[model samples]
Structures are given as C-alpha cells and as structure tokens.
Target: MSDAAIHPTAIVGQHARIGKGVKIGPYCIVGDKVILHDNVELVSHVVIDGNTEVGAGSRIFPFASVGLQPQDLKYHGENSRLVIGERCTIREGATLNPGTEGGGMLTKIGNDCLIMASAHVAHDAIIGNNVIMANYVGIAGHCQVGDNVIFGGNCVVHQFTRVGAHAFIGAHSMVDGDVIPYGMAVGNRAVLTGLNLVGLKRRKFDREEIHKLRAAYRMIFASEGTLRERVEDAAELFKGNALVQDVVAFIAAASDRPILLPRNGPTLD
Candidate 1:
C-alpha cells in the first residue's frame, strides 16, 4: 500500500494487497481481503469490500461498490468472491456483488469490459470479455454472458440466463431465456429476432460468412416443425461455417431454459 499512490483521505485496510502504480483517490474505502493489481485506479468515493480481486489497469469511478455481499437471501456469510480482469471500467453508481454458496461462490468479470453507470451485476454473474453493459442494465444472479456481447440500456436479464457470444440485446428488453451466439433479441420477455448482421459487419465478419449465418438462422427458426428438427436441419445444411457450428452447439447445449426464437416468419432480412 505504501508503494501505491493512495490519497491520504482514503481508508485502505491493512490486509489489502495494493499493487504497484495503483491509485486510490479521495474518500475510497477498501476492505481487508481485496487485491488491486497494477495500475488500478479508484476515482473517488469508491467502496470495495469482501473477497475481491481487481486485475491490472481497471478503473473504478465514484460511488461504485465492488465485491460486496450478495443480495440473495440464501447467501448466509459464505466467503464468496468477485474476480474482475484487466482494463475494465466500473462506472459511477454501479453495484457488483460477490457470489453465493449455491451459485458457486464466485462472480467473474472478464477483461476490457465497460460496466456503465447505474448498472447492477448481481451475485454469481459471469460477464465475458469485451462486454458492454449500458446504463441501467440489470444482470441477475447466475447469468452467463459471453464475449463481445452488447446489452442496450434499461434491459434486465433474469437469473440463470445464458447469452452467448456476439449476441445483442436491444434496449428496454427483458431476457428470461437463453439467447444463442450471434443472435439478436429484443422484447419484454425477449425473443430471438435475428442474426446480429450489423454487429457482424462492424466486427468485420466476411460477407460470405454473414450470408451463411443468415441462411442458417432462417433454417433453424423456420415455422412448421419442432425446434430440434429445425436445428438438426440447419446443422446438416451449414456444417461448413464455424459460426453456424457455434450457434448449433449453443442450441444443443441449452438446459431447462427456453431458447429465444424469431417471432415472425422472415423479419431478419
């Protein structure tokens, strides 16, 4: 702690391990079992508690609460943890809680994430790398958010929901089910809308790959058959593309949660 650039007014617990080049601004309070890796910055008035480990280059803004107690009633004094990776931005007023006993006792946030102001990550949520959670996004307990996912503002994801990689959830939606990789979803009880074509394009996916994914999406969501049959058909038809393979794998790996599907017949194109 002495080697770090900590403000005189801050209260860092003696048991905390503050790495070199870490900066604790005015009025920051850190708990005993916390580890702040190199170049971590607390802007001001940030409260980090419980068993938390923030990796290198992560920054915490004013009034953010990291690694606090779980909101769940079942979390009765277990020594759970919240582990955050490198280069993340925890914006003002964000509340990220540690995990519960039932939810595996670990909440993990991956690298290069931007958790915007007023967003809440509940107990045991596993947010993947490069994820952007807009302001007011609420992620409930045990949600598994995959890499490069984008959550529009004011959206709430239910507990145990699985949002796969490269998926996009539109603004004001409520997701209670599983969203497949690269799929777009938007609604109150969010249904899968289509492939994230704009996202794919922005991320520089090849045109042929996008077309193939679109075709596979249509085949899988076609009306007039069981989801299993449609997925099988799509899998057999588009087995060449790795993107489609990921989608198929996600569909097949779904648990008890309902899979989001396109609401209409052909709204994607």
Candidate 2:
C-alpha cells in the first residue's frame, strides 16, 4: 500500500492491489484487476494486464508482457485468470497469456520457474514448479509441463501435449506428443531418445533406481510386444519400483497426444 515504491512514470490502475514493499518501475502499466503480492518487482516497461495474480518475491524484467489476452480465436472476452507463482523470473520480452473459457479458464505457472528472454507460454498451459524454459521456447495452449522439466532454446511444444517430470527437450525441437518422466526428447517432431540419466544423476537419484528405470524403459520399447502389452508387462514387473512405475503409469494414462517413442520403434498409434 503506502510502502510500495511506484515510479512516477508508471501507470498503475487505482484498483490494482499492490502489496507491501512492491516496486513498479518507470513506464510500466498494471491493469485494474492485477494483484501483485508482497515484494514483487516489475522492471521498467513491463505490462501486466487482464485478470492476473503475481505471487510474492517474483521479478519481471523490462518489456516482459504478462497476463495478456489469449491468442485463441475462440476466446470471447470471458472471465479468465493468469496466475504466476512465487520466486519466478520472467526475462525480457517473454509473454505469458491468460486462459480462454474453452480450456479451464486458467493459465498457471508454478513457483520458482525461470522463463528466459523471448519465451512464450500460451493460454491454459499449466507449468509445474522448478521448470526452466530457455530463450525462444514456445509452449502452445493447454499443454501440461511437469516439475523440474527443462526446455532448450527454440523448442516448440504442440497444443495439449504433456511433458512429464524431469524430462529434457532439446533445442529447436518440435514436440507434438507426450514425453514420459525422466525421458530425453530431441529433433524435429521429437522422439524419445533415451532416459535423462544426466538429469537423474544431477538430481541425486539413486544408482539402483536409475538401473531399474532403464530396464523398464527397454522392456516397454522392445519390438517383440505390442505397446499396450509392453506397458502392462512393465507395470507388473516394476510394481514395487516407483521410479519405473511412474513411466509405466504415464504411458497407461489417457492423453490427447500419443506417447513419443524411439524413431526405430513402432509408433503403435
């Protein structure tokens, strides 16, 4: 309220809820419905519009556009929200959009995410905590990205795709399918290349757990059995191993996108 530091050049709406210690820099525009939590900072030239809530301790760099209207043609001025969680860093020129009524009316980004410069997160996407999107990454609407996922620069994900936890997407990839947890995907129309063994090790995953996951992955992708049959087999074989079972369950679950598989394997779709 009174303690907030609002630059004279900024145009913050009278109805905007500015929390304690918040800072609004020069030439920024905050829409009437925006709720900025404590200690949030918007660098110069940032624009946050629409029905949006930015959590505490977040910093948005100069020229970043947040909480803008969805790009979807079907959106018709419906009441929607864009929620960004705490400790996030939205770099310069990044655009984060609100949701449309067609897709749950919400676009949410979890805590501690790093969205690099020029990255675009479209409407209705739910990004998990600790995620990192490198420069120029574009995530289409309704995509679900799991926690700790990493996207390389210029990677583009198709709408409604699901990328599981700890997955790695290589630069310049065009991903149109589901990537399982701990998987590594690369190339145009990305395919499952292998497990993210490097990520697993970096995150301190146990060596034996990694071994079991690798074995389950091979069995699931083996050429001898149908995809469904292989999934079931892996489910039964790795029943007690959560790491392996996570992958098996992701495959078993119903999704709008097909599961990404190795290029050498059957698509099974």
Candidate 3:
C-alpha cells in the first residue's frame, strides 16, 4: 500500500496504475496505459507495455514481455490491447503479443493458465482457463485454445485452429486443424490416436461417458463408412452425450483439413 514498497530501481511511468500491495522488482519497466491490479507481482527486468492489463494475483517473471504490439504486418499501430485474467502465471522469457487490426483488437489469456518459459502467444490468440502450454510451445495468431487442454513441450499450433476442451497434444507435434474435445493427438503433424482416456480418467469421467466417446471415435476415425455415413451413425449412437455429439459434428464439419486419423489403423482414404 505504501509507495516505499515499490522498488525505487523500477521505472513506473507517470500514467501507469499500480495496485495496492503490488511488488515490483528492480529494473522492471511499467509503461503508460498499463494497469496492475491488486497484489500482482512483477519480477526483475519485466516489460509491461502500454494498453496491457494484468489482473489480480497474476505473477509475471523476469524478462517476460506482456502486452507488446502485434507482430502482424497489418497491425498499423492501432492501439490494440492485451488482457490477462486473474491468477495466471507467466514464466520467464515468455512473449505475449497484442491483437491485430484484422483479428479484433484484443488478445486474451484466461484465469489460472500456466504459460511456461519461452512460450510465444501470438497476436489475436485466445487461451482459455486451466490450459497448460509447456516450455517452448508456440501458439500462432488467431488460434483458439480451449479450457483444460494440455500442450506438451515444443508443440506448435497453427493459426486459426481450434483445440477443443480437455484435448491433449503431445510434444513436438504440429496441429493444423481442429482438435476435438477429449481426444489424444500426437506426432509431427498431429493425428487423433484415440479418446484421451488417461486424461478423461484423471478428470473423473464416468465409464458410460468414456464408452460413448470411444464409440464416437471409432465411428468417425476407424470406420470404413464415408464421412457422411460415419457422422450419421455416430449421431444415432451418441444421441444423448453432448461431448460425443460435438466430436461427431467437428469431424463432419471439417473442410480442407480434417482431423488427423489414427496412425496404427487402416487408412481411411
């Protein structure tokens, strides 16, 4: 609450708003239009740019770049914003860019997410709550990563792709299309191997729900039936389960780039 509590070595711009009980370490740069909510902590050498807002209880480590300008060529310097929700942890050397002119004007990270060191969240990306981005993971522009999703180290998510809730992406994989909820995807160009049974079990999914998801995966990825036929079959079989229905719909609606097929199975083509 006291101005003396702020490290004199840190440079807080005249227009910057520092909240009560905030702790800013030495040599940190807090720019104008930056708002640090209650009890936030900025470690040494952190750079929080203008138009950036850090919510309550978030901790930004040293050398991390929070709310910088968009990397897009079309940005044109439009005063876009970057908003980090409450209680998130941004590790050292992480770079989170703001939104571009084309993809709205805000890049957002939800509450309680853990963004590991050296991770890059590009312009206009939306990361949901409880998502884990392991070290060196790169999320490209306009990507929408759902809640509770886990990305192993060095995973690269393509632009405009949607990774559904509870999906698990293995290390060193490349995600180009939409990853369905509760699915396990791996490999260089990630493929859906099967239901994320381990994750589902850890999340305490009931047996019936797991069974339904397995059945849906079989119908969509393993069946000999045409895409339409497989979708119809899955629709009938998984009528009551919304998660299964979402998988079915995602597979059916996928165009240009379909979800990855299982590696060990017979080819669907």
Give per-residue CA lDDT, model 1, range 1-269, as digits (tens): 66799899999998999999999999999999999999999999999999999999999999999998889999899999999999999999999999999999999999999999999999999999999999999999999999999999999999999999999999999998899999999999898888888889999999998888988887888886988898888889888999999999988886456888777764676
In order, candidate lDDTs are 0.93, 0.94, 0.85
The alpha-carbon RMSD values of the candidates against the true structure, listed in the order shown, are 1.0, 2.5, 2.7
Which segments of model 2 are wrong by more than 4 Å?
265-269
For residue 228, model 2's alpha carbon misses the true position, in angstroms, by 1.0
Q: What is the lDDT for 227 in model 1?
A: 80
- True-structure lDDT of candidate 3: 0.85
143: Cα error in model 3, Å = 0.3
- Model 3 misplaced stretches (Cα beyond 4 Å): 1-4, 249-257, 266-269
Q: Which stretches of model 1 miss by more than 4 angstroms? A: none
Error of 3 at 36 (Å): 1.5
lDDT of 3 at 3: 44
lDDT of 3 by residue, 123-207 (tens): 9999999989999999999988888999999999999888888999999999887888887788888887776788888989888
TM-score of 2: 0.97
Candidate 3, residue 97: the lDDT equals 93
Q: Which scores greater on lDDT, model 1 or model 3?
A: 1
